[model samples]
Target: MKARPAFMLVGAAALTLAMGACSSSGGGTGATTPAAAPTTAAAPTAVTLTVWGPQEDQVDSTSWLPKQEAAFEAAHPEYKITWKNAVVSEGDAGKTVQQDPSAAADVYMFANDQLGTLVQAHAIGQLPPDAVAQVKQQNSDVMVTSVTGSDGNIYGVPYTANTWFLYYNSSKFTADDVKNLDSMLSKGKVAFPIDNSWYLASFYVGNGGTLFGPKGTDETAGIAFTGTQASDVTKYLTGLVKNKNFVNDANGAGLAGLQNGTIDAYFSGSWDAANVKKALGANEGAAQPPSYTLNGSPVQMKAFAGSKAVAFNPNAKNPQAAAKFAAFLGSTAAQQAHYDMRGIIPSDKSLASSASITADPVAVAQMNTVANASTLQPTVAKMGNFWDPTASFGKALLSGDITAANAADKTAAWNTALNS
Candidate 1:
């Protein structure tokens, strides 16, 4: 999950009471009848649910967690809930929950990359039909895919997306110019973190390479980074590095360059929005990743995308309530509140389409990227083998050790390492 500052969240509650009086007359005109026997309605069910989320959300009584808890309580007056909240960051929720499923929070937030682990441990429950419909209806396909297990079941409700997009200086490149990376490079200095494995695969992915499977879940399929297309991408990167307008962002070079005005554009995610805004001021422009020309055709650069989502523990005492609350946390209204209160960009499509979200370029670009120009980062355990080897290849590219002459050989070796 992105490291963000905490915000205050206040919950509003509304209750309605209905009153009625009844009387009956035995005779038409003269006789008065006794009132109907007094009756009492059944009491609401009492449910105690333990919820967990990042410390940022639980920082105070007015934070996102408390506000949502209060709202859930108000929304469902059928259940009188006693809330127990703990500080467990989304990134660590799966591991912690797996340690003791019986002791885990009934409902919790987690990064989508942990879905497989949670599924393997049977710690996360499959969303109910209503919740499943909401998840598909409210979110983009990528957000929906992120929380889906290998067995094709929806496991959670996604709230915010995790992905990178293009941040540029509007003064240097127009909207048309931003459509193609080569165009941006020709116009002004551009920085890309080719040496980082996280950003390195964008080019290859754009040129028809894939991780795991098309959806990134078929472990037997492995990585598809060899063959002609992958080699072509390698050759393209070789030339891209030699371009005077291109700068390989290593360490903090990209942001540093943007800060110093040496860089006109860089590739990054929402986490860098504030810093990029501060650096560019009036000229800041954000957009989905641009395409690069491959073998004379334009291919869209696709980043690895995932989501931060809410899930219920199947083993919880009140599984139904836990599931309902989990769905509520990722609901459209809840996501809108999350964005408003915490500046957390929402993954919910309704909120993404709202005027409030569209006004923010970073938020718009992120949603656009996730919806149109990104691949799902798979949660399979073998995905663990991908990083170190890809990073090594990226380093080699940055070092200029793999030129067009050796791009094919080097590319083949990288593919081998990925599968190995």
Candidate 2:
């Protein structure tokens, strides 16, 4: 799901990108070697740098951003850090800067998918030589690909691999119960957003629906949104609305339910972990999204996994300082602090074995899910066409406004929405 494109090239790129597997690997981390580092510039300098991140969303949300800033300052006393109070979100940064470069933060936090747009507008700066080496050495190959642009230059440093997974009340779903979808639905109250395309696509992927062509990012490939496998899976998941235990948590009523003990489990990401723990305390548990029992067998779930990264503004006054700060923000110490203080699963591979991360149930599940089972979300401009249509289709199916008998017709309507 992405914001609509203002140009045709990005849309075409995204559609093509979605139709084929990426130049990297299928889904998350693979055994492949990292891409060779590109040529870069000189060292960062001593200057005032403005930084932006979603620290307000943390458990101790208020302090984590400042803590990182203070640490960054302590290490590089020549650079002064400025915290910009704003939303750490997907749609804001790229478009705003594309419109007016001067307004972009010296270093800013943005979702992985927005990389293409920012790069297109020339709003992001190329990484310095030291930063380039640090990124490849620190983060996984998958993350490096996510932040790299069409021009082949790496534009940012990754922090969190943003994706969804299962968060359950340990007391409600036993160890065995958390392994599959139907089992969880059969025994407990599970809240999921059947209307959100990003979340809804899991069912189709688990059941063999393919989006990008054979490899995943082939420009000549095509979308399988209404193909046989997708239709079959969509029909099957639509049938799940009949389950008495399922609740639509699209607008967060489900989060409330999970917190108040009314819901047994919920489907979400690290962003929701803090509140889930506050709600269930000792009972909070997490696992990869369970497979669905289909044709008397289980189908593994595939999700849209991605990174939340920091990039330097091409227009920043203290260009070198911003580049250094951007690199510093994704460093091991900062990532660990994010995990310890904010519950954000870091993109850095070295920090996985740390005691704080190892002890956290949510962090463990997230890492397992991304490294082993999840698929990378396509970050092309065509992603703009996905969200609203799929959400509308899912809602219509889940609410009983449409059925298998009319599913094809409904899909045709969904396509029309995509075209519009």
TM-score per candidate, in order? 0.90, 0.74
lDDT of 2 by residue, 191-297 (tens): 98888888887777666555554324433344565655556665676678878998988679788898788899988988788898899999989988888887677
Cα lDDT tens digits, model 1, 1-420, are: 333223311111111111111113333344334434335566789999999999989899999889999999999988989999999999999899999988999999999999988998999999999999999998877788899999999999999999999999999999899999999999999999887888888888888898888888888899999888899999999999989999988777889998998999999999999999899998899999999998899999999999999999999999999999999999999999999998899988777769889899999999999888999887888889989999989889878899899999999999999999
- lDDT per prediction? 0.89, 0.76
Candidate 1: residue 58 Cα off by (Å): 2.0
Per-residue lDDT of 408 in model 2: 71
Mark the 10 consecutive residues where model 2 has the least summed lDDT: 213-222
Q: CA lDDT of 308 in candidate 2? A: 85
Candidate with best lDDT: 1
Show the colliding residue pairs in model 2: 19-212, 19-213, 20-216, 20-217, 20-218, 21-215, 21-216, 21-217
List ranges where model 1 is wrong by over 4 Å.
Answer: 1-39
Model 1 TM-score (2 dp) = 0.90
